[model samples]
Target: MSPERYARINQMLDNRQTDLTLCLDTVHKTQNIAAVIRTADAVGIHQIHAVWPDAEMRVSGNTASGSQQWVKTLQYSSMSEAAKQFNLQGMQVLATNFSDKAVDFRDIDYTKPTVVIMGNERDGVSDEGLAIADQHIIIPMLGMVQSLNVSVASALIMYEAQRQREQAGMYGTRQLDEAYCQKMLFEQGHPIYAKACRRKNIPYPSIDAQGQIEANATWWQRMREPDPNADEA
Candidate 1:
């Protein structure tokens, strides 16, 4: 894809909103993580932050299914680090909990940069995670069910955020920073080429993935100046 193509796709993405984020707090289930990631991408969230002890972070190719490549996933050793980073970037952290003071998830503003923090399936968000949260949100349920699965709950909240953002016209304009979009699109469209450029410490060209020059015989000849003896013709 060329920059123009990327810009066009990004424009389409912009129409669906993009700033909402998902933060997983020590979630251990691979399937839940995978499902959450898939939902995050579908909802047009630009990033997902996974906060777990360094030793606990793990995602296989089968579990992640190239989704991690398409969406930026940040793994942090501590919730404070993740919270600080998002706060510095102007994101409001909404921790999900069942406390008396928790607000309904639908009542919060989703148009701004927001991070929805989901806790482990067994214990829910850690105390430290809750401590850093700007606000607590709860999903209201009345049908003999106390709570939904973490993945299902995440999807519900993400869709709600998407709905609010769409109505507020936050999705109607380009929300992604231009430089960041360019960098991500380049990496997505040309993984090998991008890796090569990084490994070789070469400056990447402004051209898009499809415009990458292949290193064929003609290219080698052009680079080295072909000798007459090397020509079969």
Candidate 2:
């Protein structure tokens, strides 16, 4: 990677919000998914959760814009599984649903570890999703339309999170792990070689401070050889 590219990627790693994330409750619209990911990257969200029960949707959803490459998507078979994960992480799950008891999205404190569950375009949040969420939140709409689009809603919620976190100085220091930062520095900074490592099933090389690969001659030689496990695949 060039010096400028290394600096830029390193800065992004420094600003990543490891604790804030979103959960797509079987959101099937590819465009909405892509747009949400773009917004997530803009707000320094490193990853998001998704529930994809349909086999076909899972394949097609991966084709979202380049932003998808930056924001990792953790997929689950069901909303219950996603809920369990949030609980384990100590994340306060907020489901976007309009109910008598639902609170305005802005009222919730976003500085805490959070995962807002955005519902599907048509069906909205599943019954189980609503039941599992610690809080139900909704964006206040003035006009006849009851709600915004799925991706739009997610952006608003995430930005509120970003706003609160910024005020709280969450982004003042680097929160991501050192090893994880090095891994991303290599994988994203050196695309072609990273691809080679994946194709050949070779271990990822350590990345220096300047973002250069620190592998020795033996590792370099292995990169040039065909993968021994290729035939088995």
Candidate 3:
């Protein structure tokens, strides 16, 4: 990685909001998934959760690969399973639902360690999700359309969270684990080498200040040697 690239990646890591996250309760569209991931990255949210039981509905490798590289999407087999984990993490769960009791989306305190759940495109939030959510939120609309697209709603809510966080001075300081940051720096800065490490099961080497790989002689030797079983039956 070039020095400039190294600095840019470092800057992004510095602003990561580890506490704020989003949960997609089976929002299966590829375009929507990609948009949400990109928006999440824009707001410095390094992690998001998803509950997609159908393998086909999950975010594919090609969907927003750039954003996917920076944002980790933790997948869950069920919505309740994901909700329980959120509760365990002590996050205030807010679901975007259309209901009489739902509050204006902007009214919620986004400054808190929170997870905003955006439901599936058509069905909206499942009964299980609604039951577990700490509160139901809705974006007020002036016209006739009662709801926005899943991705659009997610972007608006995420930006609102970002605005609240900015006011609270939550950005600019690093909150991610040191090891995790190092891993991200290495993978993002040195994509080719990182790919090789995964392909060969080689451990990742430390990244230097200049974004150069700092590996022991053994690692260098391993990199030099091509994968012997490159092709097999």
In terms of lDDT, the best-performing candidate is: 3
Residue-level lDDT of model 1, residues 60-138, one tens digit each, is: 6678676665567889999988988887878888999999889999999887788889999999999988988889999
Q: Pick the winner on TM-score between candidates 1 and 2.
A: 2
Expressed as tens digits, the lDDT of each residue in 1-233 for candidate 3 is 99999999999999999889999998888989998999999999989999988784456667776788889899998988897888788999999998888999999998888998899999998887898888999999999998899999999999999999999999999988889988988888998999888888899999888889999999989988887658875
lDDT of every predicted structure (CA atoms): 0.77, 0.88, 0.90
- TM-score of each candidate structure, all chains considered together: 0.78, 0.92, 0.94
- Candidate 2: residue 142 lDDT (0-100): 95
Model 2, 1-233: lDDT tens digits are: 99999998888888899889999989987888888988999999989999888753442445565887678899998888888889888999899999988999999999999999999999899998899988999999999998899999999999999999999988857888988888888888988999889988888999987879999999999998877667665
Per-model RMSD to reference: 5.8, 2.6, 1.7
Of 2 and 3, which scores higher on TM-score?
A: 3
Model 3 poorest ten-residue lDDT run: 56-65
